[model samples]
Target: MCRWLAYSGTPLLLDTILYRPKHSLIDQSLHARMGVETTNGDGFGIGWYAPESGSDTPAILRDIGPAWNNRNLREIAQHVKSHLLFAHIRASTGTAVQQTNCHPFRHGRWMWMHNGSVKGFHEMRRELSLAVDPGLFLDIEGTTDSEVMFFLAMTLGLEEDPPQAVAKMVGLLERTGREHGIAAPVQMTVAVTDGTTVWAFRYASEGGARSLYYSTKVDSLRAQHPDATYLQELSEDTRLIVSEPLGDLPGAWNEVPEHSYGIVHGGHDSLHEFAPIMP
Candidate 1:
């Protein structure tokens, strides 16, 4: 459905991943190899913690246009630096093409993006929207299953336990969808962050969700391929969880198993099986 990435590690210019890679996020917007569609030109957005501030909140920039041709994105990518960041290119799955609908949706210190969507979202939107806590519901600015999912997670306690909150959200969503007669209602490769850490998930009720991957330990990559020049410049803690591998560098990327979630921070990285819990 879409292409996105979540990066956590040493501070870096946003372009280092958004534009400078052999196949960057901008390039993927135009020629995505793994997305259901090749072009994700509906819109784009980037959210990153302020460089050197350790701020709880993040700065967000989004536009309703092809990222491949967005000069503004290029300008910011070259300047903004942060230890944690999220970038997404959207391929609308029946949602309006507008700035508010772009991914990396935010609230307070949290930022989130998704690559897959709920089946029959039109039928479930009203119920799902109503399920969100009223205070958070007022903040819902876009009409996409992804945004609803974000608010749902928030309503269920995203700030306290991201994985569990998301699990609870999925549970409620899937149950609601089934009530409305749709099976296998959720398919998602989602990433969420709160300045210092990032949580990523890949799951679907049908067991075949969209693809997701994460970079291996940078130091480990260097140890395995001492001659790989790029590995030398990156910080050892750098970790990138993306909808697809940025490149085909052997031993550099690992697929996040289907129906699983991962957490990435400075020194603690973990993976766990994901299962929905009905609310």
Candidate 2:
């Protein structure tokens, strides 16, 4: 398992989101409260879009080291700023702990990260890999099921329709798992963004998907804590979707309903039930 967060809204320094919270992702790197593992130190990565660059492709910084102690991460977090970004800490289910195996995988103008696994991935690896588009297959650089799932969704049409493509990807995973005698094949809380809008999903083949949460609307938070200067500094559209809440502020976070997905985009967010459809 792993932990991750996606932010979209006003441009912000990465430090404010990654390290400022009481139970920040860096804190979770050593003391996760809701994850299957308390320590997710195998590796970590961050991907962010710089609209000023006049390009959609995101800049990614990843390393095969514990994020909590990575000086490079600390330095970058303080200096770089972006309107949208993704951060992930990894706890390998079985994959090698290399930089390439880190989360927040990127392709062109899109970036993705996941916090759960494809059960019995080794047995189902070949089938899933073969399902990826031939043109995209050559781009697969890591063995983690997370990356495979990303490309699988892209092959299924992520570039055009994210929700449908992801549903199709899960459908393919479940179908293949059944063929291999695995009862519950998929468990994921995934986030994907195309530099503008972010789509997050929480689902599992069996019930009990990993935990996921999204911040309450900025306007609501402002009303709840009128004196909180931080809330006032943010734009009305500021939003965060995380594997867990960054803090325990009342009315500040909502659990994403199980087997559902949500899209966060400039105050026009929406949540809907998710179901797998054969690809």
TM-score of each: 0.97, 0.99
Candidate 1 segments whose C-alpha is farther than 4 A from its true place: 51-54
Clashing pairs in 2: none
Model 2 lDDT tens row, 1-279: 899999988889999999999999999999999999999999999999997888879999999999999999999999999889899999999999998999899998999999999999999899899999999999899999999999999999999999999999999999899889997899999999988889999999997999999999999989989998999889998999999899999999999999999998767899999999986
Highest lDDT: give the candidate number.
Answer: 2
lDDT, model 2: 0.94
lDDT of 1 by residue, 35-75 (tens): 89999999999998874575678889999999999999889
RMSD of each: 1.2, 0.7
